[model samples]
Target: MDSTRILIGASSAPRDGWLHLDHGATSEVDRRPSTDPSTESVPTGRTQRVEAKGELDRADAASVRVALAEWRRWMAPGGELRFDLPDAGAALAALLDPASSPSACDGAETALRARADGALWTAARIERELESAGFDGSRVRVDGGRLVARAFVATSTSPSNSGMATDPTSSAPDGAARDESNTAPSAASHTAPTVDAPTRVLVWCGGGERERLRDLLATYGRVLTNRSDLELLCVFDGRATTAAAFTEAAGAAFAATLGTAHGLRLGCVALPEDAAGLEALRAAAAIRIAIHDEPLQLACLDLAGHVDPARLARAIGGGITEPANGALDDELVRAASDLHPWFYPVELAGHRVVPGLGSPCTPQYLESRTAHRRQMLVDAVLERVDMRGRRLLDLACNCAYWTSAWARAGASELFGLEGRPEHVAQARLHWSSNDFLPEGAWRFEQGDIANAADWKTIRDHGPFDVTLCAGILYHVRNYEEILRWAVQQTREVLVVDTRVQDGDEVLIDEPGDLRFNAIESTRRKVVPNRARLIAVLEELGLSCEVLDVPFGTALGVDHDDDYAAGRRITIVARKVRSALPSARLGTSSTDLR
Candidate 1:
């Protein structure tokens, strides 16, 4: 039996059968450690394992990736690698607790202090790093107050050193090597269901392999013994599962459609051959599935809507068959079908199998009017507020379009407050889909901004450097009061984007002019003219200026060439800390507000 060669960092020792490479020089270990591409620490094609217990937090992303790549190169056909670090949230809790040991608390404080200093790791970041470093079957968990991750080398010859190795031709029992060829598990497609219907089983197999595929599925049916009632929805890849094939397979048991001409029909696979077909299934599928021989893409669209990270971690830890809770697979198709038409189409992992939650802000078809507004907001902030390392507040963050923009621009910390739970979920979904902010840098909390208690919760998180009150000012009746609170909370800049009342005469306490809502509600409370907004900011000891962008950049009651029909404006207000040499507005030494 070959012994496991281990590359352990730090003085903390492990159990027997492990080799610890603890060089006396700490500087060499700190700079290179496990990720030296040229270092031939171990013999070629020899299986090696690594265990970095509580040390990853000390290393940078580039170093970590290099270490993992080196490990992959050294790993034989079936080698394993694992690492663990203190969870940032758990570390903070430990730091705040009086019962924790002084040393433990010190360690926790150090990790969090590094996080505060802009060095941190998120689950998403970890996953991306591992994948980019050539590791497959990546599993991450926040267990027992620590972040643990395990992965294996993925190559053409040896796809994974973990999980049941799958092969198309063989019925390899428990330990037999199997082929995980085209299948890459991607269940993260978070969109509200637009239609409710029964579950459909989509199968894609070649012409000659239809019978073999049926046999293979029968084996799967036995595995899913209790789930035999699921309706079979078959879509052949190319001419593989042809119409004649369907006629022979089940006769009238399946309805064979040529393509996805009709949007989301019962028991149909919308083949992505044309524009109509692609658009039809873009945001319509309740569930998407592929068989073994075909592309190994399967999305439990039902599970994608509200992903609990803990539960998702458990599901991924367990194989594809095992969900964290037993109830996840119970008639999910029906539940997904009942969802309200998603605000917009959302694509999963950029795959054609399932579309994204396509909403007006991040639309698939149009010119993305939401992107234009976000750019305008970014431009206004970059002009006055120094975004680098600043804390930001995003009020009424519907799907966090502006909040994400701030994080991308280098805001150190971000807090987004949204009234709706669904919108918050969408924001989280977007974060999971993209890498806009580092982990633990931004948080989106569900709360009605109009409520005092919720406002207090937001206040506890602030004294923020910049506050954004865009598209939300006109929704509340107490618009002036909201502006007053915003000025008080913000330390430096307050940006406002909304429709201004027509004419030079300043208007105040005016009712909403039916811009965002078709029917009037408490939400459609007030719309103040541009001058009144500027005056309120000035009264709060902040110098105000109206930032100008191109017309039609934002959506409003009217965005045409005519200014008399009301236009959207972006207002920037900066707290005058000291009198400038030029002495503008509230900052003039002669006046001094």
Candidate 2:
């Protein structure tokens, strides 16, 4: 009932209301009276997220089962329980054979052994135990020497609660109280989300030194010859410049420079004031990089969306001044930080592309977790089929990573389709540029995967030799429809890479057996097991072969049949053959090559 968090573990220092339970106190915890008059009972179907770390590894299976039951009771509907346990194989080896090698019993194992409950814990066993304790969407994976498990506590009623809890104290008891200020805007202009970054950034310099300075910085971005669509707008409020005068001058320059060449709408309006005006502009432009020319106040609107206040404060705390050499280093940094949400978290300047968002997907950020998997998929596809001078279609192509790779592997023509316009723009700016692919070798289009018009466009592009459907099947709701369309579009091979359930039997029309909503994002994603997937592919007049490469194994992850239900699978479905040949489908490395 109180928003205050309650912690129960073996921590030395204890905070207010935190019941720090040790190994000795756990018995008391188990034996405590169910009906306690002193404490207010948590509302039924209230959302509770229980996170247990380190301590679960030291506890026995029975103790864990008891803890799970207690946590489930405390959880409201749609509540989650996450735990981290010691790896059974690694920990047992360390405890039982302590003198064998100290390497086996590392710091975590040795420490946990001191308080060991003597119950070995494997990823699979942990998942089974969690499920037996009445939890849905149980996902357990091994990271390092620890087995991590996460699942939502199963509710008695159907999941119609919308996962929103209602406070009994509030007058409006339908759901939780929301801030009135966050209501939808009265103006239609304020409804649109922030537009993607523009192809070009144009600045109306009131002549002289500022004009030359504009030229220096304009090369860094797409600096539009004419206003196409306003992603970024800069108004010069100089010593003698007015907002009206700046707009007029910029319009004239745009007309004279690249008139009629531009097709997109250019948002060139006077600076806005007030919440509605600011929201309208913020929604329209990725950011309003207001660079002042002294005597100007610093007041930027906080949408509280993706841009963090702390990060923004650190970036724009001090005003940036052009260096003596006229380099816009400081200005660029400020702009980069401001446009961080718009950029694809990667800087593609010259031949080098560096990470901007610092996520695992980019090599500059983390060690590229999917690099090996991607490479394996590419290698597997190339080994079985020859793609030289062939046309290819890449579905759900994120920034044309696979498109470019396929091109390099000898695909003469490529068409990559993505749902996000931002990704399409980035793909055009980086991969499809003249420096990377030849003028007409590859093209990237933005369209919804579920849309028939997008499939028609792909169909118009001609029957592609190989249709690479990777990292996409699981995100979409109507995957069968899309897959059917993809089969109609592919000429020879259809490379399917996605997550599938680890089971011998395929799941079809099994209502209540699988979660209607994905555990991760509540999005409807059906993960078919190997058998179901192969059967579906075969039904579509294609023979399927599962690649030999172990899925998600390189990143110290084991894709075993355990706590985690979904495992990454790469299946090469051939349209020519009705069934996979024995030589091609076998597990031998020689057969794969």
Q: How many residue pairs clash in each candidate?
A: 27, 10
Question: Compared with the true structure, what per-residue lDDT tens digits does model 2 show for residues 285-339?
Answer: 4443332222222233333332222222222221111222323343344433222
Candidate 1, residues 290-367, lDDT tens digits: the string is 222223243333423332333222322221222224444322222221221123233212211111111111111111
Query: What is the overall TM-score of model 2 with all chains considered together?
Result: 0.38
By TM-score, the best candidate is: 2
| Model 2: CA > 4 A from native | 1-366, 433-436, 502-522, 550-566, 577-593
lDDT of 2: 0.46
Off by over 4 Å in 1: 1-367, 503-521, 551-566, 577-593
TM-score of each: 0.37, 0.38
By summed lDDT, the worst window of 10 consecutive residues in model 1 runs over 351-360
